[model samples]
Target: MLLRKPAASELSAEPILSAAENYSGEMHAIDTGVRVDAVEFARGRVALGRLLAKRGIGYGDRVVMAVANGPLFAAALCAVLARGASPLILHAKTPAAEMRRYAERYAARMVFGDGSSETEYRETGLEPYLVEAADWARLLCANVKIVDESAGNVSLVLPGVPLHPTSGTTGQPKVALRPGRPAIAEAAHYIETTGIQASDTILVAAPQSHAYCYGMGTMVPLLCGASIITMRGFEAGLVQSALRDTNVTVVPAVPAMLGSLMFGTRGDLFARVNTVFSAGAPLNEKTAKAFANKFGIAVRPLYGTTETGGIAISLPGSQAVAGICVGPAMKDVEVDVRDDGQGLAPGLGMTYVRSESMMTGYLDENGLDQSFVVDGWFKTGDIANQDTEGRIYLHGRQSEVINVAGMKVIPSEVENVLLRISGVIEAKVYSREHRTGSQSVQAAVVAHGVDDADVRAHCEKNLVYYKRPSMISFVEALPRNATGKIDMAALSNL
Candidate 1:
């Protein structure tokens, strides 16, 4: 009698780890490289896995991770997968209050990060692990006893949590929990569609917690057996050095990072780069062309969201023609641009996509809100149009998603914090478009005692730097429309 071996569930990281083991490439960081072959990857996985196991982080337990984007963070991610546990990865500099709230919300078994972050987590009265990314890299290098593997050679489990968070009108963060683990197929599609090579070295220049960075930095490279060069944050000096020193094949960068490279540094930055993908926000076509002219590699626009996965990528070797062309829908993905038949041919309207990687829906106090997803199509709240050539041209977003150098900031989220300050009766935030084609956060506040400086200081303590209001107008009262609703246009004009 012939029998089939047990298979991992749909959402586990095992598939990628297993495939990664077949390739001999190491995961390189600013410090050094760690071999990713099956045996070596297993060693690191087991060492960390044993540590987590000792801490009572076993199968199905949830762990919260607040670490910088680097080798140690990557190793912790591997450890989470090895122990069959769910992880909620946050920015290394996430505020202590925010980190504690997330840990409580997710019911995390333990928290992990560097010593400094651990101190923050400790203030929450929760169990936290203080581990360094460099130390994990070293541990992966040392000879260690292999812990017994999980029950299956490939075990997939969906975390159903957030490494990225979006917000609602109420200013509360909402996480989309996709049901199944189709990550293997999703990652494969990304690898194949992006033309990833086994010999390639990928550079992740964004925060590892961001969706784009996590997918490009962690998933795609791991599955393809490609070396990954990561940074804790967007450091221009570190990025320039990595590109100059390493034959960096692909760079997944936001527009701001590329902008710095354009004006601050030049020459041979693109000598070895196979592809450079600009996502999170739009890139200036003029600067893009100038860089392409100098480097021989065109800056390609990429479009995706925390909910939509990666929707489109600029076709390799293709230059922008007219509007912002985010190439075409990736493999195994279908995009249907709906305009209510407004007679706008290839009209600008809401974008919808059906893909294996689309998130199930938003999760919050309201439970899962799949209203955004009708049938199998997920509504990507961005306004876009597609030409006959199947290229996607993005216009703007449905909501005020301030793109401060590719860091997404929801206006209501900042406004909520603004309202919390003493004497702040009303608050409205908006995005101001810059000459460089990117956007910055700005706000108009109606308060009694707070000055512009006070408002800025409040935001500094409450929100991330990108989310803080760069320009603030302390108005006596905000203008309202006929319906008694705050006129966003008038606020923007202010």
Candidate 2:
């Protein structure tokens, strides 16, 4: 395992929820079809923490949350942190079996959100708590801590920051633990780079499960005392509506979401947006140009990995794209290219980084193919070249980390799922680029009896929307080359 918990704090730091309450009452969070002020959001965390405390959850306990992006989700995360219980925050659409596996592995105290089976958890001493939106909101209003602001002085003691999930070649999920020490600094960095003002209303339109969105959208905005507008997920029409309704100034979105919103009929929707920042995947050249032409602004790229969070981000008024450039590294991030022993000026090689919030490595697994860290630098498997001005341009990845929309899909993970099918003999999954300049998951399977639909259905059970194969082809055999190995070239042709 590559994960190591940060040194435990002896003296109490300030409680995250209490710090959040320092935001002015005028600051609000909009999501789940309702609006609540910043104090109320903080109060929600306080009250939820009280409830967890009452239920015997204490410091260092693990809470599994499967939540969508919204104010409640953000507040719940804060509640876990305030109570000193680290969260294993899962995507709302995570499969039930995977949730169970995580719960069992960690011996989770509670599971919150959808797709968690009550029966499976009953045996593991795990408690399942389905989030009641109305209840959390009501609890927000009912928090006694908010009534007496003196309670803000007592800080919450965390064992560490919350955890992030990463997958290996075998497709078994592992937790990547980040250091809590750099979290607040990274949040402040976003505020400094973006020039977020007290009155700015940042939009949390992307998935909160992403470290970027959670840090930038939830954490930074709260620290800056800025308001936020969020939706569950990005739909072109829904996002357009939120933009109009909220007059959203700053948007944290992925390239695919931007492509969908821009290419559609909703023109002039981005007029109010001060900036559109994209991460999760590289913004395609075609998408960037179209956005700049239509909106009179470039879609800036925010590049990083699940392991190393926020390596580089394009600040406001910065040019969004210049030959696949992802601007310069953000504050407190050191970037290096490990090309033999060459200098760090700029050449194609593996990207190495030492960042404020980078994870130690994967948890619960003994060893993996490549070491996540060397010396002190975290090895990012991206092929890149940096210009003299410090602008970095990505060529591609050294591994098969497929970027479908903005979500990272490990090819072997999908291939492993395919092989699980009863009639499947061999399976290979790869991405195919569409003319729209986006990628789709495609699979070629050597199987009998089961058709393409069956294979797809099986995938639907295990994988999320983006991870499922968009197209499936069943054949008598998978073509092999001179070495008697599966030929990805011939597979792509099929």
RMSD of 1: 12.3
> Looking at model 1, which ten-residue stretch has the lowest summed lDDT?
139-148
lDDT of each: 0.65, 0.65
Worst ten in a row by lDDT for model 2: 139-148
* Pairs with backbone N, CA or C atoms under 3 Å apart (clashes), candidate 1: 10-181, 11-157, 11-181, 12-156, 12-157, 72-133
Local lDDT at 254 for model 2: 73
lDDT (0-100) at residue 8 of candidate 1?
A: 41
**What TM-score do all the candidates reach, one by one?**
0.71, 0.70
lDDT of 1 by residue, 1-494 (tens): 11221134434566655654564566655643433444555566557767667656677665666666655666677677667776677767666656656655645556665424444545655444333222444321111111322422112233423334654323446765432244455566688788897789888768777777777776776677777777666677878888888878889877657656775666777788888888766554554766788778888887777676777888987775412678888898899888854333246767888887876556444233557666778776666778898889875555656667756675655766777787876666788987889898888877787798888788889987888888999887667532123566787677
Error of 2 at 30 (Å): 5.5
